[model samples]
Target: MEIFWRIFDTLILAGGFVYIFIRYGIPFFDNRKKGIELSLKKAAEYEKEAEKLYEQAMDVLKEVKSEVENIKKEALKETETERNNIIKDAETAAEKISGNYINQAKSEIDKQKKQLFDEALNMSFKFMQDIMQREMTSEVYGKINDSFLKLQEEAFDRRSNK
Candidate 1:
């Protein structure tokens, strides 16, 4: 009879616990499920925003890369232009210097030629005078002087007529 009563009491307690869990635990679990869903939705939104930022950064990086290439091309072109100008200027300077050197050389050669001609003429004149002095006596010189004076007078008269 006692064992029967204990079994009955245990059954009663088990029934009460099942009723409480069904009434309270179900609502608690449902609330927790809704909270988890809300958190997952927020996480998805944050992930989308992060993806959009990454795309924008990539676009900016591409533009910056293209701009850097353009700048490098311009710099290379400018450098090439400067190099050509330097070469042209150097060539012009070299030509001018070469022309000046040639002119100086020609002037020096002409000056030497003139000096040689003058010296040769002076030498010839001295030789002729020495020969004339050695061959001619004083009587012959006096006769040559008289003849030269006559020839000068005749040349002067002919010039006055013309």
Candidate 2:
């Protein structure tokens, strides 16, 4: 009789515990599982979105890099062009300066030649006067004076015509 009562009490207790677990624990665990599944879904969506953003950023980076390279090349070309222009301008200026110097030198040479010719003419005239004073008579002097006057008039007329 004691064993039978003990077995009956144990069965009753076990049945109540099972009924309570089925009524409450299973639903709670199911709801918890649903929440965990929803969290996993959201994490997957976020991962996909992050990958898309990364790809877009990479594309943008590529374009920016290409643009930077193009800008660098254009700047180098402009710099080279400007350098060439400067060299050409410098060469032109040097040529102009040299041309001016050559013209000035030619003019100086012509002026010096005119001055030397004038000096020689004056020296010859003075030498002729000294010789005439030392060696010539009055009649010879008169004749020489007449011829000299005629030569002087002819020279003056030719100079005026030129």
lDDT of 2: 0.95
Once fitted onto the true fold, the runs of candidate 1 whose alpha carbons sit more than 4 angstroms away are 1-39, 139-147
In order, what lDDT does every prediction score? 0.95, 0.95
Give a tens-digit lDDT track for model 2, residues 53-161.
9999999999999999999999999999999999999999999999999999999999999999999999999999898789899999799899999999999999999
TM-score of each: 0.66, 0.62
Candidate 1: Cα lDDT at 4: 92
Error of 2 at 7 (Å): 16
